[model samples]
Structure formats: C-alpha cells, structure tokens
Target: MARSYEANLETSDELAAVNEMLSAIGESPVNTIEGDSNADVANCRRILNAVNTEVQSMGWTFNIEEDAILTPDVFSKLIIWLPDYLSVKAPSGTTVYVNRGGYLYDRNAKTDEFTQPVTVSLIRLKGFEEMPTQFRTYIIAKAARRFNIRFFGAAEIEASLQLEEQDAWARVQEFELEYGAFNMLDGDAWVAGRLTR
Candidate 1:
C-alpha cells in the first residue's frame, strides 16, 4: 500500500528520514492479548503481541502527533531537510521545503476570545501521492516527537473510504486524536499513540 512518488519532491530526505525513523520504532513485533483489569504480566504481553498485529495490519504507517511538536525549533530540522517540490512556511513566514502534509499553526490562539486565527494549514506537497507506513519508523519518527500521538479513532475514520485522506482535513473527517487520551510517561507522552506503526 505504499504510495510511489517523484524522486525529487521537496523534503524527500526529511520525509524519508521521518519515514525511516518511524520504521525503526516499532519493527519488532511482540505478541500479547487484552484482558480484564486483573490481567497480569502475561496479559500485558498479550496486549503487546496484539499491538504487533495491529502494526502489521497497518503496513507500518504512522501519524506524528503533537499537532506539531511543542518546540518550534524541532521542526526546523524538517524544514532544512525537505526537498524542493515542497516547502514549509511557518505562520511567522519561516519557510522550508516539504512534499507531503504538514500542519503549522499557533497554539496560543486556540481559545474562544482569541483574536488571531487559532488554526493551522495542513499543507500537502504532492497530490495525495505518498504517505509513510513503516511501523517502527512511523512510531519513532512520528509518534515520539509529538506532544501526544493517538490511534485513529472511530470519529477520525470514515468507513466509506477505508483510509484517511493524504491531507488531514479529509482524513480528520474520519478519525480524531484527543489530548486527554494520552498517557504521561517519564514526563513525556506514551498514549494517544497508534500501533499502526
């Protein structure tokens, strides 16, 4: 299910890097199963195993969450690594090359009384041509950097399409990721993440 594309699209490396990173995070599949609250270590193992299946089924594609990392500097690396066909332009007008989809917006504007547009643009470099799907790479490259990553929820999915659109706006119509769902681990996020790898 990999989407093939032009070799020289913008941010190809960074995009590839992100893709590579995701491929690394969840490649090793472990088997486990789900159980009631009393489920012990064995059950946990089962759940982990199930996660592996989840990843395999997904063909290893992952979505980086955090609405764009909290630290703006982190994104600079991506901007610097992007190819020419695509470019990233921050709300502040800071620009970079990127080919796929990116979301850049100010979080401080999310409130009701906000004066500025508390929204971001989900930029797409290609015409829904490519998206990452390497399981482990997807998790590390995409899930780890975000403030929180989440599984594509029922609301975030549209059964009619079977998959989300290359652009989140279209996909968003099908599934959703929420803040509360994320679990805090070691002062970082471990929840709101998907095993879709």
Candidate 2:
C-alpha cells in the first residue's frame, strides 16, 4: 500500500494552541454560581446548551451540560466544568465541572474554548542528531513502513574539505549526504533507515 499519511506542519500550530488552552483552563476558575441551587442548575443547563450549539458547529456531539458540576465563583470570568472523560467528582461543598478533551463555556467570561481533532506523524533520524526530534521520528516511521529500506549508518559529513563558517549542511548537497555501511559497527546507527510493519 502506498503511504498516504503525510506529516502536516499546519497541525503542529493547532496542537500547540490546544495545549495552551488546556493550560489556561487548568489555571483559570471553572465555574461560579449565584442564587439558589435551582438557578445554578439552570446556569449549567444553559452553558451546556450553548456548548451543544458550538460543538455541533465543529461536527462533534457532547453532553457537557448533563455532566458538569457547579462551583462558586472563585475567580471572575470562570466556571469549571469537567468533561465526562475524566472520572472526577465534585469537591466538598462545591460543584464539579467536566468537559473532557473538549471545549467549555463561561457565560460570565464570554468565552468558549474547545478541543479539536488533531493528528501527526513522528519521525526519527540517525546520524544527523541535529534533526528535529519530531521530524526525525516521522521520517523514520515513514521509512520503515513505506520504503522497506534497510541500510547502514548515515553520516552527514561534508565531502568538500572546506573551512565552513556559520553552519554545516546549509545547502543540501548530493554527495554530502552519506549513508553508513550495513553492519558497519553496531546494530544501530543507520544513516537513513526507516522500518515498516
């Protein structure tokens, strides 16, 4: 089968944003309720209803309202709602809030943060320790599965004995890229080897 899965750089930024939001949620207040318990429950129901509207727009269905626990406002513009995915209970004398791997709404805060679907391929590279861990991991994974290529260690050594300044391997040279000999020294250390299943 042909390798159809390509590593998407755009998704890296998206994942980073998602992670940042998760961090923000972890720090910020989740929920606060004034008035009686009935009003608090109403607020949760409203938040969940709004969440349904938001999540459905992104092609996902959720039960945030039914699963959230209400809490007193510890901080302004915050209402914590734990998602169902997390098996947590309400704190003592406080409501529990959950929104698993997804978005939650804060009516007072006027924000609705969400979790999105993301995918990535990790690559691994030998010889060139300078290669990015993620890029190398992706390359290695792709190589193993797609190329069925087995080889020796790889060395990105400069063929030209020139006094380099600033950096090495700046330009992608043909001969500069060298592969190691199979069974060269150790079992590992292949220049551009990738395994497939």
Candidate 3:
C-alpha cells in the first residue's frame, strides 16, 4: 500500500510523541498509549513523562503563576496542601517556602501552619496537553534522543537525533524569548524590596 504524503494539521499528542520516540529507536508505533504490552512502548511513555516534568521544572512563563493565593484548609488549619509547584516562594519577602510531605512549609518561619492566606509566585507543573507547542516539540525531541541513546546507542543515529534535539531546543528558546517578556528586574531582590513599600 502507498502511504499518502498529506500534511497533518493536528498538533502532536502523547501518542504522537511516544510514536516519535519509538521511531527513533527503530520500533513500530503503537495503537494505544498505555498497556501496549510492548516493552519499548512502555519505556517511551516513561521517558516522555520524565522529560515533560523536567522541562516544566525549568519554570517557563507559561507554567508560572504570579501572586497566586493559597489558603489554608478549613478543617485542618495547620495543613495546607501544596500545589505541584516546581519552585514556590512568597511574592515578595524574605520568607522561604518549601514542599514538605505534599504540604506547604514555611522554611523561614519554621512552621507548616498558615493562619491566613498566603500569596505566592510559583512554577506549577502542567499536563502534557497544557504545555505550549514549542515546549512539547522540545520535550519530544529530547525524549527521542534519550531513548535512542539508551536503547540503540548508534553513534550516527545519535548524531542525527542530537541535531534534531538541538534544533527543537533552539525553537523553544526562541519562543521563550519572544513571549516570556523577561527583564533584568525579574526576581531581583532590589525590585522585590520595592514591592513592600
């Protein structure tokens, strides 16, 4: 049968991404994402998720929430369930916060309790579908490169995949530069000090 050369208009999904990874390692694409009974498919899915989480943890503007308020639970005033934040901190203060036992902990205050609502700036984890297209492409390319290296370890193929990975990374960086609106004042201690005034 002849394969059509039609362009795909839809954006890449988890299945597509996994298939890309599988293809990188000289494996056939799977019909479904999970429970494929193929060890290679399972490995691809795992690598994809791990790569997604790692990339999101880099704190892109898309995943960052500013001045988000997190209130304590009414039933358990002392236990505030923390969001899946990659890194979290007070919007502006010396106060440091950490995720401890899936709860928000005040490192500076030495307490896990919050009497009042806390405003924070955090980079939260977003699902694969929630990620921007540029980031998604980058994650898939990176994952494919890693999978190829882990399984096949072919020097020539790795070199080719590395080029793709680097190209994808450059695209992601370009997207960030255009949309992130980053300035020197971002996360500046001096600028944060002024917010207190």
Candidate 4:
C-alpha cells in the first residue's frame, strides 16, 4: 500500500517510534497503536517504553528538576509520594533521601515520614512526546535496533544498526554537554578534595 507523508508527519509520538521499529524489521508501518493490535505492534510498543525509561533514568538536563519542593501527605503527614522520581537528592541538608516504594524514604531519619516540606533535586521520567527532538531521535534509533534484533537476529543488520545507535548516542551526549553545563567543581568529589587539602 502507498503511504501518505501527511499520515506520518507527526513523528514525536509513540506511534511514530513503533512505526519506525516496524520499518526497521521490514514490516509495514502501522497507523495507530492501541491495546487491540497485532503482536508485533504490542511488542514494539513495550520495547519502546522500556528503552525510553532506561534512557530517561540517566538523568539528563531535560528530565532533571532542581530545588523542587515536596510536601508531605495532608492526612498522614508522612510518606511523600514521588512515583516518577528516578533519582533524588536533598540538595543541602543533613537528611539523606532515597526513593523507595514510590515514596520518599529518609536514610538519615530511618523513616519515610516527613513533618515539613523538603527541597530536593530529582530526575523524573518524561513521555516520548515531552522529550526534545534530539532525545526522541536517539530513543527511536535505539528502540529500532533492539526491535530488529528481537525478531530477526540478523548479524549484519544488527551490526549496522548498532553503529546508528552509537551515532545517535554521541549526538545526545554532545547535546547533554552543551546544555548540561557540567563542571568538576560542582560535584562532591571536588568538595571532598578541597576538604582534604
């Protein structure tokens, strides 16, 4: 069947990612992704989500939030739920915070209960559409490579796709360096070095 460019114009959504995966495996593009779909469509969608989550968990500048205020539960006055937080830090305090069971757990206090508001820096997972074009492109490329391997297991094709994935990753790393403004002075290692000196 002849495909219209208009139908595939919006390329930032999960459907586009799955369709790209389909195309990578020499399959026809799917129009829409839904629960009631073919096995390939379902598997592609699942793999895409898994890959997206893995990528976002790396704490990119786009996904990380700084100085976020989290309040305790109104009724219980404890257990601040942060279901989307992949990584978290107290920022500046005696408390050591960790996300456990989708809630804020205090390692210093040995409890999940919080009596007052807490300020934290955290990385949260974002949906595919919410990602910038660069990130989305990288994710789509990586997902396609994985999808190709799962169904075909063709060595030559997988090798070529691995290079594509690596190139996409390099672009993402460059984007991160430009936008993340990473500095050795800002990290804990530098602070420890100064203290020792």
The TM-score values for the models, in the order shown, are 0.16, 0.14, 0.83, 0.83
Question: What is the TM-score of candidate 4?
Answer: 0.83
Candidate 1 TM-score over all chains jointly: 0.16
Regions of candidate 1 where Cα sits further than 4 Å from its true position: 7-85, 95-122, 128-197
Local accuracy of candidate 1 as per-residue lDDT tens digits, 1-197: 64322322223333343332233333322232223243232332233333333333332113222223222334342221222122233433333323333433323432122123222222323311144333323322222222112322233223321222124233332332332243454334334243223
Clashes of 2: 31
RMSD of each: 19.7, 25.0, 7.6, 6.4
What lDDT tens digits, residue by residue, belong to model 3 across residues 1-197? 63211111122477899888887777888777655688887787778877877888888979899898888887676655444567788877467788788788999988888888888878777767777888988998998988987878889889989999899999999998999787756557778678778
* lDDT per model vs. reference: 0.29, 0.27, 0.78, 0.77
Candidate 4 residues 1-197, lDDT tens each?
A: 74321122234376778888888777998777764459998888778777887888888989989898888988776765545677777876456688667678889878887788888878787766677888888988898898888888878878878998899899998999899888766557768689778
Counting only residues 3 or more apart in sequence or on different chains, how many pairs clash (N, Cα, C under 3 Å) in candidate 1? Answer: 43
Position 16, candidate 1: lDDT: 40
Stretches of candidate 3 exceeding 4 Å from the true structure: 1-12, 185-197
